[model samples]
Target: MALRSNPTLRQRRLGAELRRMREQAGLGGSQLARALGINPAHVTQMESGKTGISVERLRTIAALCMCVNEPLIEALAEIITDRDKGGWWEEYRGRLAQHFLEMAEIEYGAHGLSTYTMAFIPGLLQTTAYASAVFARGFPRLPPHEVDLRTAFRMKRQHVVRSGKTPYSAYIHEAALRMQFSGPKVQAEQLGSLIEDSERPSISIRVVLFNVDTLPVNHENFTYLEGPIPELDTAQMDSGLDSMLYDAPAHTAQFRSLLKRIDSAALSEEESREFIQSIKKDMERNYG
Candidate 1:
């Protein structure tokens, strides 16, 4: 089979998981290749996601690595056999960075999502006007057409949360609510949208208030996307112009821990709504 010159995030994830398992098992590429009766270079390519592995090969690898987690094994199997191709995000292809497409798939496939942001409402919960205002402030200043495309893309991404099937929990800082990102009207509308979304049974919105005491300096924007199994979980943080997904077990655990700590400092769902409503009223009073 021809080696893939470039692998999508999902494909790369499969390779990464295999590499992790092999490391945990204390086996190197040469050893694995010898045992699997495949060329060592092929093994390298497969582990790096440059080559596709058959379902049989994937299971063989897991068995060799002695991965005892049935759920994780099944999840890996499903990932390899994922034939849905992709949707929506594929359309934007060259128009946006590949990271956006990867993120869309991540958001769409996430069984649930836990997000924490210090300066903005979670994108999945942003209103169209709010999204436009945020996008408009993009660095380098995108053209009008680019901004519109991005807004439309973001709106479609919101469907994942609005679908009401996948649960979403957002821990937004009070500072984010107060930011006049797109001006007071846009900010007010955005806050109102958060309150409205909070009503959905699958959605939980909390505010990390200003008086929550000093938090750890590590608190930054991140979204933990739940995979079918905990081992498949991913932590996403934005980098320059693109997003990065961390699938390592340690990284996943660290992000989950941070989320717990952040959640601990956040207001309860009811309190968050009240907090947001007060902010909205204040915006009307001050910005109007």
Candidate 2:
């Protein structure tokens, strides 16, 4: 069996909470270990996210820390238990990075998701052909099979939007609507697909037009996910080199501000549909 590489987000969060509780109780690792009848090193490992904690141990620790809220304790316990089990993405483990896997799991668990794209369509909305073309261009040296696997993974993620599990909102730039990474035909198809998907009750698509002077043009891609707990809301920013996930209140607030700016600059639903249809007509005329 493959050894676990590092603690997942859930594990990390739980570990942080445990450490916080211990510190609040004014107990050091050794003291807590003695009180719980566990080894100091074991307690240290759990606090550092280097070791997993069982449900029973978690309850004992919570009680020892004077935690009275059953809901919060249960939530933390769920994170520990859930992390131990394999998620559906485990099947595609070798093909995708750990960050992408974590994002996929979080997306599945989110109650709502909002995205802003400046360059290209977000992966969740891209058609297979569009996704393939984008991946091919970005990874020119990648093998065809690898590109195919990436496309498949992206396609699978779109289910979250199609199904009613999580509501999603997207704000896209007008440039992206006109940009043709693949041939015009593929681009046109992608735009049409977006329009159709946007009509879904759980999906909202708004386009920031070129004439919108209020729009912020800092070219960055971001995704914000909201879960059952307010603290679980997170924002992800793409830095070209890598993606960074932010959960700090300040960072999340900044993302929320950016999203609001984009939303304010974007065309309304009817206007966006008209704009997309106009672009599709032009693509047909030029390419067909």
Candidate 3:
């Protein structure tokens, strides 16, 4: 099989997990290659996600590693067998950045989602008009047509949350509510949309008030995507034009702790709704 020149995030993650299992089992690359009757370079390629692994090979590797964690093995199997081909994001492959497609793939497969935003509304909750306005602010100034295309892609991405099958929790800082990225009208409409979305059974919206005793120092915008098992969970962080996904156990655990702190400081669902309404009314009263 031809080696993959550009493996997706999921593929790379599977390779990392396999390497971890081997390390835990106290085996070297050459030893594993010898046991599997393959060249040592093949092991290197598999561990780096440059080559694919069959279910049989994966199971054999698990046995060689003496890994008895059934749940984790199943999770790895799922990644190996995933045939989504980037899911709905495939259509935008050449049109949008590869990062967007990878992010969508992970989002679609998440069992649950938790997000915290300090400067803007969560992408899944932003209305079309609001999304357009947000996109218009892109650096280097995108042409009008490009902005429309990007906004449309973002709106479509929201379907994962709108499907109402995946549980989602969005924690937005109070300051984000007041930022008129577009204008008063768009901002008010976006807040109103958020109010309606909060009513959805599968969606939870919380507001982190400015008056909280202490806020986390790490305010980077991030979304924690829960995998089928805790071991596969991922934390996606976005900064400017870069998007980073961290699935290492330690990193994911730290992100989980950060989310817990944000949740504790945020208002309850009912209170968040009222708070949003108040902000919307303020926007209208001041700029109507």
Candidate 4:
């Protein structure tokens, strides 16, 4: 088969795990190639996600590497074999950046998700007006058509949360709640929407106030996507124009720890609802 020119994050992750398995078994690339009956170049391609691996081959790899983690192996198998199923995000593939589609795919497969934001609302929870404002501020400024396209893509991403099957938790700073990307009216509506979302059993919205002594991490926006197995979890960091995904054990662990700390520093769901309500009322009074 023709090798892939651009592999998705999940494909790369599966490849990475395969490489790790080989290393754990103390087998070099050439050595593993001999064991797998493939050339060294083929091994390299597999490890770089430039090629696909069959389930039988994956099983052979696990057996050769002496990997007994059944769940992780199962998860890896799913990743490699599930490529044929195209997601709704595929429709936007040529129009949007690859990261956008990858994010949607990641969210769709996530068992649960947790997000932290300092300056803006989490994308999954943003309203159309608020999202449009946020996108409008992009450097080089987006055309109205592009803004609408991006906004639609973002709203589509929310489907996973709206399905009520995935548990979604967002830890938003007080500053984020106060920032009126468009204006107070839009911000107020966004806050009110947050309150309504919070009432859902699967959605949790927590507010972190400015009074906290210090934050565990810098004021970056990130989302932690929980996979079927902890080892497969991913952390995605977002800057307005770009996003980076990290699946390395250390990085994901650090993100997980930081998110936990943020969770602790945040108000309880009920308290956060009241807090958001207060902010909405303030906006209405001052700018209604």
Candidate 5:
């Protein structure tokens, strides 16, 4: 099979697991390929997530790895054989960055999400005006039409918040709230929207204050997504140029620990509401 140029995060995760299994079995790609009757390059491709594996081949590989758990093998086989191509982002396939598209797919599939943002409000919670302003600042030379289209795409993704079925929790630093992305008026509106969202049962918003002196210095924006299955839990870290998706146990454990620390340092639900309201009032007093 021709190598897939754009592999999904799920595919990459499965490939990582397969590579770990092979290493644990003390087998090299060439030796494993010989046993499986496939080319070593193909084995490398599958393990690196550049190519997909067939269900039968996946089972055979699992057996060779001494993975006796039928359910685990079946789960791996299912991800390998998955043919679902439906996603809301298909229309913007060539327009947006690959990292944004991947994030959209994973966010849509997640059962729950936890996010920590220190610089700006998370995209899912951003108002259209605020988002547009931020995007415009980043893409200063882009044509007006292109800017509007990108802004609309971002606004459309906000529907994930109101879907009601899935839950999303965000721990935002006080610095993000203080930043005036679109001047005082837009900032006030954004803060009001956050307060409104906090009232929703499925959405939790907390502020991490600078005065609190939190131990973990969260400088990057990161999100932890809980999938329907335990094995599929994933984390995405924003790195400006390109985002990174991690699903290993070690990465997941680190995120879980950070989540605990953030939750502890953040203001309580009631306190968050009051804090946001106070900021909004102050902004109005100074700007209005």
Candidate 6:
């Protein structure tokens, strides 16, 4: 079969895990190639995500590599099937950066998610108007068509928090609530929408008041996407005009720790709701 021209993140991840397992077992590509009865180049191709490997072959590879993480192996098998499924995000392939589609796929498979934002409401919780305002303020200033497309794409990403079972916690700074992105009317709607989304059983909204001192990971906005297995988890953050996904153990651990500390600095759920209510009332008094 012709190799994939552009492999998805999950595909690449599966290959990476296999490569790690092989190295841990002290097995070279030639040794594995001879074991699998394929050329050494073929093993290299699989490790690079240039070609798909059958589940049976993957299991054989694991056995040869002496890998014993059953759960992780199962997750890798599931990722194999996932690559075959052309998700809804496929429709926007060439229109937006590949990062957007990869993000959607990552969130779709996430068992849980935690987001931290200093300058804007979390994307998954944003209402259409709020998203439009946020996108409008981007550098180079997007045209109306692109803004609408981004808004639609963002709204679709909310499905994981809405209909799916992925539990999500968003730690938002108070400044974002007062930014007044579009105007009073739009801001009011956004505050109202935030209140509504916070009520969802799967969604947790926590506010890190401006007064909160020394918040964690204060440098930028990011989302921590949790996988079924710890080894498979990833952390995503914006890098320039694109998104960067981090799956290295150290990076993932740092992100997880950052979240724990951020949660420590944030208001409790009930307190956050009350805090948002006050913000909304303030908005109504000033904007309405």
Q: Which candidate wins on lDDT?
A: 4
**Ranking, lDDT, top scorer first:** 4, 3, 6, 1, 5, 2
Error of 3 at 280 (Å): 0.4
lDDT tens digits, residue span 1-288, model 5: 678897777777778878878887899999899999988998888988999877888888988988776766776776766645668887888888777778887888788999999889988999999988877777346677777887888887777777776799999988899888779999999999999999999999999888977557554689999876666788889887679888877888889899998898899989999998998998888798
Writing each residue's lDDT as its tens digit, candidate 2 over 1-288 gives 232357776676677778877887888999999998988987877876778878999999988888776776777777876776776777887777777787787788787999988789988999999999888887445688888988898898889988867889988888888888888899999989998988899988998877878666464588999856665568888886577888766777777888887877788988988888999889988788
Rank the candidate models, highest TM-score first: 4, 3, 1, 6, 5, 2
Query: What TM-score fits each model?
Result: 0.95, 0.86, 0.97, 0.97, 0.90, 0.95
Residue pairs of candidate 6 with colliding backbone atoms? none
Q: Candidate 1 lDDT (Cα, whole model)?
A: 0.86
Question: What lDDT score belongs to each candidate, Candidate 1 first?
Answer: 0.86, 0.82, 0.90, 0.92, 0.84, 0.88
**What does the lDDT read for residue 211 in candidate 4?**
98
Q: What are the runs in model 1 whose C-alpha is more than 4 Å off?
A: none
lDDT of 2: 0.82
lDDT per residue for candidate 6 within 93-208, as digits (tens), equals: 99988889999988988999999887888889888988998899999999999999999999998888988479999999898888888887778888888888889888899998
Off by over 4 Å in 3: 84-86
Compared with the true structure, model 6 gives a TM-score of 0.95
Where model 4 places Cα greater than 4 Å from the true spot, the runs are none
Point out the worst 10-residue segment of candidate 3 by lDDT. Answer: 83-92
Off by over 4 Å in 2: 1-4, 20-40, 59-71, 216-219
Report the lDDT of model 4 for residue 74: 95
Error of 2 at 37 (Å): 4.8
Cα displacement (Å) at residue 219, model 4? 4.6
Relative to the true structure, candidate 4 reaches a TM of 0.97
